[model samples]
Target: MKTETGTPILWTAADAAAATNGRLPARLPAESSRAEWQATGVSIDSRTVQPGDLFVALRGPNFDGHAFVADALAKGAVAALVSAVPAGLPADAPLLLVEDTLAGLEDLGRVARLNFRGKVIAVTGSVGKTGTKEALKQCLEALGPTYATAGSFNNHWGVPLSLARLPADHAFGIFELGMNHAGEIAALTRMVKPDVAIITTVEAVHLEFFANVEGIADAKAEIFEGMTTAGTAVLNRDNPHFGRLLAAARTQGLGQVWSFGRHDQADARLLDCSLHATSSLVTADIRGERVTYTLSLPGQHHVMNSLGVLLCVKAAGGDVAVAARQFSQIQPIKGRGLRKRVPLTKGSLTLIDESYNASPVAMAAAAAVLGKADPGAGGRRIAVLGDMRELGVQSPSLHAGLAEPLRLAGTDLVYCCGPNMKHLFDRLPAALRGRWTESSAELAPLVAAAVRAGDVVMVKGSAGSRMSLVVEALLALDQSSRAGSAVAALSGS
Candidate 1:
């Protein structure tokens, strides 16, 4: 039997050498202790380095992490994983020298997977990968010890970093694999070789890299490349690309596949869903077994994805009942869909933070959530939106496409920012239009000053748009005196 602990082991020099096929460079700092060379976990950024962590200095085309090796050490890093020693470091610095730091990180990840005696699950899709990955982590953790990718760490570097940090003793490991171009997921999935792979859904995200949605679907199907021979592929049967994704998975020799959705053909079928303003209660039939669970997350997309989460749990031979019960503990990830109230003077305002990445599909989902929000007696539903990037030549059309969804949501007012969103701003009716600006930086102050009591403000944008600034500015309003604030609630229509 394996033992799991929240505290990591001292990843000793010998252990790292064996895992990564690297060795400590000669140069013993006189003040360094033996433990200084042993890492408890692996980190890439100097600013986020934890005391006992091995700071992996990954070099990119723009910036070099090697430049921060000393800063990482000063932040209490146990060792620095570097391809080349930097200037001014002690002769005996806790350095695990490698031929290539990236390759070394991959090697360590491979070793971690080799030593892991637990079920490994991989999640991929156009959207909701992080949310689904998080749901699984929460579910599996309730059943037993589990590890999952942190935040949206689902890229080439993030995958290896998360895997290399996997504890030897755990019941489950969940990884989120994301890619824009083809062949990316193939390489990552092969490294993970998950026992179960899930494609949450296929959408028009990352259209900048592919010629069409089919091309994006094909690229997403690459996650099947890493499935074990006996692995199960959990798919979204309701998605338009479900047939294409299912065919791709079957071609890869994944015979056991479970289709999850509200459709009749779905193995994990939705029986019923009681939707709420802030949460949902869903009853699902998992391959003939019926179970009901309360998901604290809002949006129909999340409810649909929870079926996939339960499917993954059942596929991993876990107790579905136990896992389903854990759904209540699932909280909205910050900037993803977290709900909070900013204390105002007379009354508080509801804040829905969706200021993370966005796409056409994601924007619709966010709008749907905003629609269902039960604003206060005098409150109004407001959307603070920034540009959604990476649509290539279709950026303007896609941006303009959001107008109908906003109308359907009965948004009392709309605040638009960024050049791409101007197309949508022009299409809005004068009654619903609040303001429009070329940039979120300029729009943030105006939106912040406009928010008032009984208002539910939902902010969203692409990663490059920096709409979080608008979210920050609105949150800052909560800090001001609630009484007689500049923001006044819109008069009842």
Candidate 2:
């Protein structure tokens, strides 16, 4: 069905009500004919609701989405899905009443998956899931209408929300599944039921919750639980847990297991690659055919993940050549290796914002990118790092271990924050130490002040560490300096 705007209708009131076992608004008659009333999209946040969206009022520990029902309607939401009737809404407000809003969302997602007539792929790993999912989306969209999870929406609620947003006529669907503990992926994967599953590579992330990396591998292996016997499992060949994940996938009855890496026996094997500061040139034997492409995003991690993405495209019967060609168009998103120049008085300082999240492996990758960067004349490589969270008892040692990578990266100056980061700061050479603070808030200004016009600064930390504060501080420097110059000019005039 299409709306008057020629947009494809995503859901009808009748179909949605039946899908979620919800009751229509009281004002509507039991058999009222409202087939013409349809939604063009689905949204969970009231602030982002579009004109013809079905806004699901999800509840969380700190907040209830029901409170925003009226606001969502005012902002053009066609109807609000709520478990309880919110007070202060108009008498004729459109609402779909359900026993539980979250369960209702799950129902919508399950029904959508059941109705979709397309190939589905699920991605899960300690890192690179979002990048791989986004890459696949770009490659598949070149062939036909493709739907994928937005950003890193791969949790329990996030997965269902992404699934519920799937358009009815998409040719391919990709979902990223993430877990901090065992059984989380099992629950999410069952809902996705992807035909192909990709485990990018498991690492020592979220180690606080598990006994060791092996436990993390077992938890990641749960991505195979929802697959049928005929599905394909894509494993990372070079990772230490490859055998464990492969065994689990086979035991779960997956029909095909494909591997990608520099290893000799990898199905999608890397033939050659050059990692530059902002891009990578790669030649790989994908399945059987040798393909070469220049990926715009740098780093070996990205290079390896690209092989998995192309293998997925081929596994789903997409044109490998076309998919390989699409790699050049991909760029890094913000807080994920996005590079920009901030104007200073003499020259501009390069800023690499990797402040979104961090783990040991991710930190090393970011540092490698920093190592390749070309600092301006008389400039130096600088790293402003925050704590890598959830490392448990290994947190201190792991934190200190980062010293080697930073030193090898030729980092001229280093600023560290958080209690865990103190270990790393102490490990750095005396000449490389810029400052160490108990928190990022205290560390931000010092790093911002120390950056010179010719320097290149990279800020990175876990989400909980609030390392973005340092990036914000560094960015604000340009504006403040410009303001000061303007004021001086006005005074002279």
Candidate 3:
């Protein structure tokens, strides 16, 4: 891929101003000596400004980018996009002032999306949005040049920033859109106007903000509000709300609606599935033809999700086999399900890092996968759980209810943290509650001490609970040991 020069290359300043609704300041430099200069890239952070890159001086709630205009200029930024003039910038520096930095970013994203020549796929869900987006990016990239949103950049600011930074000539683009409030998706989707939209599954997430699960469903369905008339909407047939989503798509006048799940009549149906310790072999009836493949990632849920990805690839005008083959390279994202091997004094151990975010639905699924985990030779299944937040008035009962599934899944020991999780801790059979802590930080040491060779440790919690901290603490122990060569001699000849 060609790299964009980090310089202010304006095709037409008038067009830029028009796109942003003429909020630009008059005193700023408008005419340039050269008409065809190169823009290296766009950035919100002035510290990363490169030569010719346009520095977007956005005003954040805490810090103002305008404060860093001098830094951006010193770092070789050719122009600064701002809502207000800063104190230290030179009078001659080019400035594209707008009513708001965030809004300006949206306008720039809209313009970039409109000018691009590639197919765009937008993904959203209560869960699996990031994982599925990563999967689609992996699959789609194999067929042609592809661009995808980096990390979990699927928010109000992230969506626009991703779209604005898109390279003009890329072959394909994938974006993940997320929201917990009404109208949020509508606003973000309007900018991308995706060629294909994938709704992974609607679940009870962000329940604190919603009146009920149906409200969350309505909010998620807003992804179709800005979809192009000819675009396709990929839905999950396994989700109970599939019918509602289907009707929503129809109301939006979407030309195609594809479904994926275990249902026999789904557009992309899972005919059979075999889950192993680290991967799953799946046979699916995709549009009538039976195709079988091995998923590099474990979990039956992932196998079902892959159907959505395959259908989306076809919708995006790419070859299905090309995309399917790319699955071999897909791995779970961190805090989602990325597994690791840690060397302990007793022996090497396996850790399932699902500390990213959790809901009751997802937690149950993770427990099931943990139940089937390969303990190597003598390992036990250890589940380290934290609070699953935002269940509304049913929080306590819902928390306690997890005990049944954990027991059914044959979890050998359960280590729990957080107040809400205490309910589950109390409800568990005394033998199953291995340890409990008021905070994840305090529980980290107990977990490390209890882990044995071949044991599979699954850590999970909602984002608000910060369960990733415990995951980091456990992984860091391995690094500290490695640094001291504590385990090197044990395995040596």
Candidate 4:
């Protein structure tokens, strides 16, 4: 997708140096003007650098990108952005020096955003930020060209990097903003200045850094800091802090505010929803119009999140009908409700990969999706959950509370990892407690052994717990099984 304006060609060596405040070791050759350069793209990673790209050497926590400057240059980076010139770089190489490469990259991104003329949508929440953002991208892409943050790139560096990467001719832009502390979203949102801001929902996430849920809500509200004066603010009417968040939007002088949920007054209200084995049929009242559609993805939480996307698309000057029809193409992202098939001796199995990240609220939602999963024949519902991190003193209670939902959802088996998850394990009925381990690595083997044909296995956990490793191990077994079959075929031949 192209940005609304043609990509601004800031290709002159002089312009690059000016962007970084004359931080270059030497001015670019006088003859090298914008007309002489043609950039295919830009990148911060040396490994992914393409020919004629500008490489940004940022210093990360564990590794310094400056170390890869030579490799990037050798791989065809036309220029480099660094805090200092490399030890032995040629004098003729284009080098833009700055006080901090990361900051300079952000500044360049800001400049790029200033030149972008398309509508921008910013998404954030304690959970579902990535899923909701992807949904919005899917819907908006149907109407015209669109640009969205790649994967879960919604943090400080990620936001700027995504913005900077925005092509100059896209009709729409979608960005996801995430934060764990106060003022982080405020700073990032300012850089985005979204035309329509969506708060998926606020929950007791990252409580380790806050005194209470209200504090978390305050942090999420900071997303409005960069909203345009006439922008639209989309909030979840079902959330307890809806009024508070609404007030925050008003204080920022938002021209329009839309609510999505089952609330009667919600601008986008859920009229009826029927959960199926794989997906949900949702009928919603969008500004008083009754519209029914089936989401290709599972989970009622996803349906709820889609309402925000619908309102956002309308706010961004897109056709609601076209956007609504695009839902069929929507699929769950990796480690976030993405399903896979595993072959077993008796039959095939279904694996729901929700191992990306989790919280108490998200755990309950996932368990509900797992409970509703349909096993074709003689199959059972299974849940493999890890600790919901950052719950502060409430970690034990919150973890234990999931047992009730697990039971209510009729999950046949519950496998848990992490010390915090032990609280839930203790609370589960003995019949449902399939397995438990102190770590995901130790638990993955037991899970692989337990999963059988006709079983719907759903795996979930916080990112820090490395629950995705369990998913990887399970998939590895599937791959190995396939490899063995191929070997047998060759031997038989």
lDDT tens digits by residue: candidate 4, 237-266: 999999999999999888899999999899
Residue-by-residue lDDT tens digits, candidate 1, 160-184: 9999989878899999999989999
Each model's Cα RMSD: 3.9, 1.7, 3.3, 2.7
Q: What's the TM-score of every candidate structure?
A: 0.94, 0.97, 0.91, 0.94
Ranking by lDDT, best first?
Answer: 2, 1, 4, 3
Q: Show where candidate 4 strays beyond 4 Å.
A: 1-14, 23-36, 483-493
lDDT of 3 by residue, 328-407 (tens): 77888889999999886557788899998899988988998898887867889999999988788878888898988898
Name the regions of candidate 3 deviating beyond 4 angstroms. Answer: 1-18, 21-37, 46-52, 75-78, 483-493
Off by over 4 Å in 1: 1-6, 26-36, 482-493
Per lDDT, the best of the predicted structures is 2
lDDT of 1: 0.89
lDDT of 3 at 360: 90
C-alpha local distance difference test of each model: 0.89, 0.91, 0.84, 0.86
